[model samples]
Target: MSDAQFWEMNPTATEILNEVKARKIQEINAAYTAEAQPLIKEYPLVEQQSWTAQNTEARAYLAWHADQQGAAPGTPVLDNILMGRNGETGTETLQQLCLAVIENAEMFTQFQQLTGKRQRLVKAVRAAEAVEEIELISW
Candidate 1:
């Protein structure tokens, strides 16, 4: 509204305008949340694939780790495989296994960093009081 028109508004009209503005803001916030929710939910899966693709050794270890029922890090599984124990043949050389473990560790560290950044973005989105503030947030 023009300053002159707004200044001339009756109390009832001003009240109604305020209510309309509040409602519009609520709708904008809801829409932003709807758009952001799916991205938050699917981020891990999408990032995992992307990260693994960029790190070939990490990808190989991931597949092998899955076949081993998702072995935890710091386990003696690699040693056992090297020693030909636990029904695991010494198929992978020590150097290959070591590289896989190192690469996997590095990949995991990167994943955690990205995930933490995403979580912080989520917090910023939640705490924002205006559409413009929320719009500044990125994944």
Candidate 2:
């Protein structure tokens, strides 16, 4: 599914989309090709492949899009302080919310495939103490 659908599913993402996008970009380009890459506009080495280059370029562009669309408010975006009443101390981060949304029973598999973070997502879902506390039901 397109990234847009992800945001659509998790409306809470709007507040911290930058964090989510930054994270997703890293996941998308963890280990790209070295030299055998695809060439979309510029040029690659003689030993490079167009398909690989194109894929890398595309992923990077998507990452750039993620950056543009989902950058945090500051350099240390993850360090935001949360304050609420009724002793609600734990601050469910945007990444955590994204993971929760990704792991929702309705679209777990789709998000796993789309984000390619199956292990992390699964682990997070399993570790979350209050998945239900984070409301994803849009109305």
Top of the candidates by TM-score: 1
lDDT of each: 0.54, 0.38
What digit string (tens of lDDT, one per residue) describes model 2 on residues 1-139? 5568756776564434444444443443442222113211244344224333333333444454466776533312112211221136675654443333333323323433434443454344344344342222111
Candidate 1's TM-score? 0.36
In TM-score terms, candidate 2 sits at 0.18
Clashing pairs in 1: none
Tell how far residue 69 is off in model 1, in angstroms. 30
Instruction: Return the lDDT, model 2, position 46.
Output: 44
**Candidate 1, after superposition: displacement of residue 28 in Å?**
17
TM-score per candidate: 0.36, 0.18
What clash pairs does model 2 have?
18-70, 18-71, 37-53, 38-50, 38-52, 38-53, 38-54
State the lDDT of candidate 1 residue by residue for 73-139, as single tens digits.
4424455545763255446764465565566557466556555655566666556655566556554
